[model samples]
Target chain A: NAGVTQTPKFRVLKTGQSMTLLCAQDMNHEYMYWYRQDPGMGLRLIHYSVGEGTTAKGEVPDGYNVSRLKKQNFLLGLESAAPSQTSVYFCASSYPGSQGKETQYFGPGTRLLVL
Target chain B: AQSVAQPEDQVNVAEGNPLTVKCTYSVSGNPYLFWYVQYPNRGLQFLLKYITGDNLVKGSYGFEAEFNKSQTSFHLKKPSALVSDSALYFCAVRDSSTPGYSSASKIIFGSGTRLSIRP
Candidate 1:
């Protein structure tokens, strides 16, 4: 099974452009997350969803929005891209159960370049 | 507030030698700590985690980490370093009972540790 898949592996956009990054997981996990990786910032959370129809803000949610319309899909939307938004974005999912098991599976990632 | 710090920007070790990447965390209550490794231009991969049960937790790729409550640290360790082990390492922490984690959870990651194994 495809653990996690992110669409638009690479993209280049001029400033003020709009785009959406899609993430899908087949594990039926209840938790999904979006993160961006910069040179020295490591990975910073952008947005996340617990399940279908549920979404929440994360550590760095200023320039993005998210939707979890489907249980297996999470979408990140950039209303207006900027040079600061040029970074590798990752999508991840996890299963949190009664046993306190928290293992996150990640997608390859989308590399975006905003000029 | 929860946060993580990987003091060393880069660590170099000879192959076959024991390797250690340091990490420290700050959080209220019990912290669920985690270690993840990333290859060049790749997503972070889970290595191990420390919850309530044990201070030393073992995970994939012969990697392990020790949890020290007194020092508020969870450092990643490997008995022997390998060329393939060279990668970017991250430390993360979260409070299991934090209000922000009631639904979809978010984690704080350390700056990152670049481990290089010299032949």
Candidate 2:
């Protein structure tokens, strides 16, 4: 099983340009999340979804939006990319309840460079 | 708030020697700690976690972590290190006492530690 897969392993964007990052998980997880990894910031959540058709803000959600139209897919969109958005983005998914609470499978990560 | 700290920015150890990566965390209630490893340009892989029971939690790739409630630390250790063990290690924590599932269930990660096992 391709636990979690992200589209466009790498991308370059200019300030103000908009793009959507696609995240797909085949594990049939009930929770999905988007996080950005910076040099010294570890991983900061941008947005998350508890289930399909449900999305909520996270620690750093100001410049990002997300959609979980399907249980297996979660998409993060940068409406107006800024240089500050240049970072490694990761997608993760996990099952609900206590069983899978501590374990989250992550994607390879997408490296975004906003010029 | 919940937070995690990886004291060392990097650690160097000889292959075949024991290795330890220190991690400390702060949480209001019971802490669910975890360790994750990331290779160059790769995603994070779960190593092990401490929810309850044994303080010494063994995980993937021959990794183990001891949870110290009093010290509030979860340090990753390996009996003998391998060159392939050189990678970025992260320490994370989550508050298990949180009533129900929400964004509060999110795990907080430490800055990270670069572990280099020299051969």
Where does candidate 1 chain A have its weakest 10-residue lDDT segment? A95-104
Which runs of model 2 end up more than 4 angstroms from their true locations?
Answer: B103-105
Pairs in clash, predicted candidate 1: none
lDDT per residue as tens, model 1, B6-118: 99999999999999999999987788888999998778889998888878899889999999999999999999999999999999887766754562454778989999999
Q: Considering every candidate listed, which one attains the maximal TM-score?
A: 2
List chain B TM-scores, each candidate.
Answer: 0.94, 0.96
Q: Which residue pairs overlap in candidate 2's backbone?
A: none
Estimate, for each residue in A1-115, the C-alpha lDDT of model 1 and write its tens digit.
Answer: 9899999999999999999999999999988999999988888888888779989888789989999999999999999999999999999999867323487888999999999
Instruction: Give the TM-score comparing model 1 with the true structure, all chains together.
Output: 0.95
- TM-score per model over all chains: 0.95, 0.97
**Chain A superposition TM-score per model:** 0.96, 0.96
Query: What overall lDDT goes with each candidate model?
Result: 0.89, 0.91
Candidate 1 Cα errors over 4 Å, as ranges: A98-101, B99-103
